[model samples]
Target: MKLFGSYTSPFVRHCRIALLEGQAQGTLECEFIETDIVSSGKLSPTKKVPFLTDTLYDEKNKAEEVELTDSASILMYIREQSGLTFFSSANDYNLFCNVNTVLDAAVNLFFLELKDNILPTEGSYLERHSERVLSALQYFNQQEYPTQAPFSDGELRLACFLDWGLFRKRINIDGLDNLQALLKAARSYDIFAQTAPPEGA
Candidate 1:
């Protein structure tokens, strides 16, 4: 199996963490290929990072290769294939949705700031995006989240998104104690420490 994506992307990082955790449990093994989005255009219909290609063996010993495009889909596929429990319950699934909201808003703001040269403070559209980012963070911070060794997909993605948003200066997380504590706890895991986004990103 092979995974493709940039090191700085939280979406990609979440998948990497899942694979890492799976491997730690002796359930998964694969290679990660760091590919630039522009250069990876030919790799998938979405032309995005975190693309996956897996070779599967059938009952008859026939080899079949499968491709996955979306990060969520890729993660789900990894969990199913490896029998690794990525989500512990419906609440975990709900938390994943909440964290995903933050990621989506932050990503839009990130691209708007970087690619379109639009700052959040400069327009209502961008400002709304910032509002969504803060709302999600504030709500998540207040929740009594469960602690999972190797981190649940929601926990992993939340910490990665917070770090990335902070690094990019896309959102301000003032007085978010729970969120801060979550990040600190997540770092205790080697997967998060090793898969952290590059410095100066």
Candidate 2:
């Protein structure tokens, strides 16, 4: 199996973290391929990072290769291959969706800010993107988690999004207690540390 993406992308970081955990569990064996997604079309139809190609053995013992393009699909395939469904319930799935929404907003704002050469101002699509990011963070702040909740895919994606947002200067997460706590907790894991985005990437 091989995963293609850049180091700075939060979506890619999420998959890298999964690969670490899955490897520790003895269920994953993948090679990481860092490349320019915008210029790389041979692997991804979207021309984006977080693409995965897996060679699975079929019931007839034949090698069959499959490709997964989006981060969500790639993560789902990882869970399936590792036999580790990190989402425990519908609530987990909802949280995963919420985090992905924030990720989308952050990416959009990042691009628009670069294109316009200014921070997202009021009454603009970029401003709306900023609003969505903050609202999602605030909502996540109020989320209740069981004490000592084991790290799961939802948490993994959330941590990656928050950290990447801060790293890229996409949004502010001030005073979001729950999110801060979760981020701190996630960083304690060796897998999270191992998958940290490259400096200046």
Candidate 3:
């Protein structure tokens, strides 16, 4: 199997964390290809990183290639194959989707400022993205988790976004107690530390 993406991308980071966990569990073997936007764009129809490919064998022992075009799909495939479904309930799934939205808003705003040279102004898409990011963070802050709750996929994904947002200087997570706690807890894991983007990258 091959997982193609950049180290700094929150979307790809979450997938890397999961895939690395799978490897530790003896459930998966994959090549994580560190890639860039210009190169990965040519590899996928969507012109994006975090694309994945795997070989599947049937009862007849026939080989076939399976392509997953997005992070969610790739994560799902890994979880299914590994029997490590990190989502335990409807709420977990909802949180996963919500975190995905915040990641989208945060990354878009990051690039719009750093790469696109389009600063956020009142009522612009950039401004709206900022609004979406803060609203989602506040919503996550208002939620509660049980003591020592399992650091599952939803929380893991959220941690990726929080770390990336901070690293990129994209968003302020002030007063978001729940999110702060989760990110802190997730960072304690060896896998989280291992998959983090290269220092000074």
Candidate 4:
């Protein structure tokens, strides 16, 4: 399997953690392809990073084909293909969805700030985005996950998103206590430590 995306993207980092965990569990073998999303013309369809390709086999003909595009779709495809449905359980699935929503909001805020070189003129709407991000962080800070396992898909994704957000200095979120604990737990893992996003990414 091939996973394509940039190192700095929180979305891509989420997928990368999943891939690494899957590999450690012997569920899948993943090849990481770091692509330049801004310059890459191949990801035009989805216009995003973390595309995937897997070979599907036919029962009778014994043929193979490639599948591609979109991080969520690709992740689902990989989970199904590898029979690693732990992440797709109905209970965990809901958590994944909720956490991903928070991640999306945070990423949106980051990009909006980036749009004007991190300087917002008075009366700019960027404050609204910042408000949303802080609200989400506050929400997360008050809740506890069902498990503290390092490899739980929801936990992994959440951890990756939080750290990547911090690395970019997009939002301080310093008061989010639960989030800070989760990040500390994530950092304790050697895999995550080694896979930290590149400097200035």
| Candidate No. with top lDDT | 3
Question: Which prediction has more favorable lDDT, 2 or 4?
Answer: 2
* Candidate 1 residue pairs in clash (backbone atoms < 3 Å): none
Could you tell me the TM-score of candidate 4?
0.82
Q: How large an RMSD does model 1 have?
A: 1.8
Model 3 whole-model lDDT (C-alpha atoms): 0.83
> lDDT (0-100) at residue 190 of candidate 1?
79
Residues 1-201, candidate 4, lDDT per residue (tens digit)? Answer: 888888887777767766766677676777888788574466647677778776766878676867667666776666666567646477567667776876776676666567755643343565665666667778667777532455567677777778887898766766677788888877878777767898876
User: Could you give candidate 1's per-residue lDDT for residues 149-197 as a string of tens digits?
Assistant: 5567877778888878777777666788888778778777778889888
Checking candidate 2 for backbone clashes, the offending pairs are none
TM-scores for all predictions: 0.91, 0.90, 0.93, 0.82
Residue 172 CA displacement from its true place in model 3, Å:
1.3
Q: Which stretches of candidate 4 lie over 4 Å from their true place?
A: 39-41, 86-91, 115-125, 146-148
- Give the worst 10-residue stretch by lDDT in candidate 3: 143-152
Q: Which ten residues in a row have the lowest lDDT in candidate 2?
A: 143-152
Q: What's the CA error at residue 61 for candidate 1, in Å? A: 1.2
- Model 4 scores worst on lDDT over the 10 consecutive residues at 117-126
Q: For residue 13, give model 1's deviation from the true position in Å.
A: 0.7
Candidate 2 positional error at 125, Å = 2.2
lDDT (10s digit) by residue, model 2, range 18-96: 7777787785789988878454566677777878888889799999888888888888888777778867888778888
**Candidate 4 lDDT (Cα, whole model)?**
0.70
